[model samples]
Target: MSQHFVLIHGAWHGGWCWDGVIRELENAGHTAVAPTLPGNNPDDDLASVTFADYLDAIAAVLEQQQEPVILVGHSSAGFLLQAVAPRAAKKIAHLVFHNAFILPNGASQLDMFLPEVAQILIDAAMTVATPHGSIASPHKNVPILEDLIRNALMKDDSTEVQNALLSRLVPQPFVLFNTKVNTNDFLALNIPRTVLFCKDDRSLPPGTFLKMAQSLGTYELIECPGGHETLFIAPKIIADALTKITINPTFHAIG
Candidate 1:
């Protein structure tokens, strides 16, 4: 009745972001592990990090588990999932995209967004040339990212909660969005895929979540309450949804 869950945090966040959900899962007698991606740490050099570094970090954590785990990817981590799933598909029991992006092969995360939105993120990346003429990976502006969190992710959250979570936000390695990902093995692998939606999520407009899930061709649709920050803001509800997915083999199919 117990399930192992490897929760993958999206960009700009570390494993610590999943503390709330982890507690809920633990309390429910299930296991959850949120791994820290390399270079995601404040002390780490983000400029030196690559997309592969992120994949390697997740893969390392996946390898440590003796049994297959319910692989849950949040936000941009859906793209991260597509890139790493193939390499360790056998160890993954299910694919859970929690208000996450689902990109196709040979496509970058930016490809999923509107041209203006993608360009905004692209233009937002600050580039610095090195002494050796090499260019550093683009870095996101901390204030800009913080504002987005306040406006979109935490729109429904209280000011206190917003500030608390905002303090935890870190600038992302922009290269993660720039990298083009592909995974043939993951596509060929047989795994139950589920897409969980938060009705109040404003990070992307309404209908965007289902749209991304639709791109997967076929998946189970599970909906809950709260916004994009629901994982932490409404942990119990989110955890309950996760439990429902874990126990129910048959879900309402979408796409």
Candidate 2:
């Protein structure tokens, strides 16, 4: 059966981030769409972006598709998917969390991170002032924080990929990370869910993601060998997993 896949990227990344994975999925005869959330690119206004803005982008893409989509979200996008699932429940055939954060109802991305990690993010965001006159972390342009960011997020990725990613990354709105998401509606829908935990992910830490996946009640957990950015590091593995889920609604743990 043919399936449509919508890939949502995480913080600091744009639609281009999924180019590699999109091509792989297309080669396998599946349709994939990677949309850039507003304010994440150079032409976009970083100041005006909000969590709702990101959700709307995903929802709009889902609305145009006639067939159910296997919605995949990575990194910070995990929270976006949870919010989007309830609104586009019927259009979503399955929800795949790729080394992404999975927040419970009324919980924020900060809620998923360790207290120390969360504080680091908060402190970083406090340093910059946005167009809205709010102090937030200007993550995209900060060179001094590269080591910290790389250590926390892309430690498993090749140096080339990590460098390329850092150059193109943009500042994410702090509010997006802090906003609490109501995932109860999504949980109640009983959507087929799978969490792809990249074993080498340095961003969220493997142990933290494992614990979160376990708490999701009904979810298939798959582990891959790579860092937080598997799309670039291991597109073949990620693509294969997507194909498996499309072929069988049942979630199976994979390497």
Candidate 3:
């Protein structure tokens, strides 16, 4: 059966980032929609963006769909999954977290990242001081970001492909990572969930991610070959795996 897939991107990326996965999913005759979050928009005021803006954007996307969608969150969007699911629990068919971060209540994404690791992005970013916090320097830190993404986030693509991706990367707002969400009702939501783990992805340290996925109470485990950027590098694999889960969400052990 054909399914509707809503792919949510992580920081420094927009709906553009899901092109590959969308193509593969579409090829399988499944409809897919990926909404670019407020802060991630090229013309958006990064400093003014907030966590609520993201939730609103996601909710709007869910509203556009007539049928339940197989919701997929990537990277930093794992945090998005925790909050978004509870709000749109009835609209989502399944929660597919692809190499995403899963944070506890009151803890921001910064808490999940290794200080040194988070520092790399922090030190590289140039944010302007605001009443709330700060906004990042758009493309001003691309040189450092290039090295970071290559060595950390994505490792399976060619230098040329990575460069292309770097060109599209935006300097994400601090608010997106600094804000924390309440997952009290999220855990209680009865939606089926799954984690798409990339065995070779060092973007999130090994052993740590499985522990994060396990925190979801009960979730099916799906493993595949590739790194944190597995969705881009291996779209067919991801699309196929998502198809399987959306069709039959069976309980399994963490990969």
Encode model 2's per-residue lDDT on 165-246: one tens digit a residue.
7888877777778899988877677678888777877776548877766546777776667777778666887887777763
To one decimal, what is the Cα RMSD in angstroms of model 1 from the true structure?
3.7
Rank ordering of all candidates by lDDT, starting from the highest: 1, 3, 2
Q: Rate the local accuracy (lDDT) of all candidates.
A: 0.80, 0.77, 0.79
Candidate 1 regions exceeding 4 Å error are 127-144, 246-252
**Clashes within 3 Å, all models in order:** 0, 2, 0
Candidate 2 residue pairs in clash (backbone atoms < 3 Å): 125-137, 152-203
| Cα lDDT for residue 154, candidate 1 | 81
Q: What is the lDDT of residue 142 in candidate 3?
A: 19
lDDT by residue for model 3 (194-219), tens: 88887888876678888877678777
Query: Which candidate achieves the best lDDT against the true structure?
Result: 1
TM-score of each: 0.89, 0.87, 0.88
